[model samples]
Target: MSVLDTAFVDTELSKKTSIFGLHLWVVIGIVVGAVIVLIPSNLFASLPRAAGAAARALPEIQIDMGKVEHRVVFSDRGASSGESRATSGAETGSFGDENVIGEGGYGIVYYGMLADNTKVAIKNLLNNRGQAEKEFKVEVEAIGRVRHKNLVRLLGYCVEGAYRMLVYEYIDNGNLDHLAYLHEGLEPKVVHRDIKSSNILLDRNWHPKLSDFGLAKLLNSERSYVTTRVMGTFGYVAPEYACTGMLNEKSDIYSFGILIMEIITGRAPVDYSRPPGEVNLIDWLKMMVGNRKSEEVVDPKLPERPASKALKRVILVALRCVDPDAQKRPKMGHVIHMLESEDLLSRDERRIARDSSSSLREEPSASRLEQQTKQ
Candidate 1:
């Protein structure tokens, strides 16, 4: 599928309400109930995700729209008192169906405008059983103090009676990019439990920005890994993480591999609509590669085909990232090196990647594996 096709699928899917929303919606609910995690992104490290060359840091402003009591809880270097007023009046109107740009179990994301006409995405969280409240806290904690070129910016938040909302700098386009910063750049590694195509957004310039931190987990240096109940999207969750509930940066590397496959093939991680052999993306891709039919894996919709060597490098990198053994998966930094290098992988690395793909043929489906793990 092409970029256009992915957009169409998203449009059709989001319009229909099924369980929490669609695809791995139910799995996401499990993640919210448990402690979530995050991944990394280093694409365009010098280019900021927000607009303008002179990036301005925003404060976490808490607004009581009902009682007209508002205060800035966390202020950054670039934030100003006047800027707080700009976001205070953002939620003056109703968030009807027309304003909704996206939706999930957590809440509806609406396209709103500030007094200065700055475009923003307002997440109208559903505070059912306090899940939204918890999500809000996690999201804020994950990104409130950090600023990255590849991560979306949290402008502010609002609390009006039962209404809970988060304001974010609106990103118009939809795409994905490198995520090495979260794993290597930060002191306490941030592991994004849910790393899928939908969570990544793009700006007008087409620079990909990683979004949605409601399922992000922060891992300190003291602990090697955090063992919690299973969390994360079904097919994107790492097998070891799903089976043992041991989450670390490597689990994120596995999800990133799935995401790479999604971009290259324009296919969902798990799709039952396809033929039996082609239903599971990883299984199908592995079969194709194992049979030396790797050329057939690229999306047919791509206007121009990639050179064989370039394509081979991408496939090998993805296979390595998704290796069943988290220990075998390369670090995000090494993954980036593989992606950027114009040269092909060494023969040894190529054999390892190929073996990695072949090794998964006997394993159960990603969703089934995760479900069985949960059981």
Candidate 2:
């Protein structure tokens, strides 16, 4: 944990009073964030009481109070070379209105082009209750220095008082919540709590980009679980996270499992239109996989050939990810391995074995791993 300066703590806390008698925890969260900003990134592995308590809170950013500048520009680059198109909200009144790509709980995303004709998606956060500020800090903290082909780029940001905005490279298609395929890279794991299809966006070449960092949580390399409030789409949430507030990388695996089912079956996680017992994808898929009738749940529209080999493998991996017991679930590495394997059983071969089975089998989800002890 980074050390906190006692004098600095007294100075900042004295300046700001909790207007609404906000909970001590919330105030402490801010104090912790303030302290974190004064330290180095490598020291983030261990945070003191305040920071550890508020798992979702971001480290405080140093704003130049003297300038009182209407526009605040924060970028991944050391120094922004020219007038940025994203900071227009501070100078004028709008980010960009030419095209509205999408809108969500965080803010509205606009499609625009920069001076060099570089296309970008600018997010102007609705600074309603400081949610935008937290989102900006978290996104920058989680992904600012990290780069991956599968992840969306966090190009820049504008923190002009009440106006908090983010700039990202525009994705051609929508979020993964629109598309249904993607898994996290667990080595230095970043859990995208809300893993619905809409969060998955597609680029010009059709590669998926994962976006939205408001509800994201970064796990320290040495830690196995992060304790925090459970926030995510209802159907896509892992059972363990929903029941208990404990979350780890497996939580993402479970959501990915649900996503796979959605991709293959063309069904949402929760559909009341379906039969009573099978309303939840988790429950329905469990029944299908156990009955040795996994083939029954595939999307009818998926062409026959690839669906048999690739689709079955996809479903199998999805099932592994969604396994009710977090411990029983396979790691993302193992899941990917299975997905790419050629010799895995085909639908017909697996069905033959299922037909001869005398009794029902327990799947990872149905069997349920013993409740995990809080880490």
Q: Pick the candidate with the highest TM-score.
A: 1
Task: Report lDDT (Cα) of residue 209, candidate 2.
Answer: 57
Worst 10 residues of 2 by lDDT: 366-375
Whole-structure CA lDDT of model 1: 0.58
Give the winner by lDDT.
Answer: 1
Candidate 1 lDDT tens digits, 1-375: 133346653453234222122222111111221112223333224334464545345434344343344443333421122222323444444466777787755567878666557777877666433445455455454455556656677666654445556667788764333221233446567677767667766677644566665345677789979876566667888999888989988988898788777756768889999999999888887676656566688777554555555555566667777888787788776776666555555656555554554556563223222222223
Give me the runs in candidate 2 sitting further than 4 Å from their true place. 1-99, 105-107, 112-117, 124-139, 160-164, 173-188, 213-215, 305-313, 344-375
lDDT of each: 0.58, 0.53
Off by over 4 Å in 1: 1-93, 125-139, 158-164, 174-183, 227-231, 243-245, 347-375
Give model 1's TM-score versus the native structure. 0.66
Error of model 2, residue 296, in angstroms: 2.1
lDDT agreement of model 2 with the native: 0.53
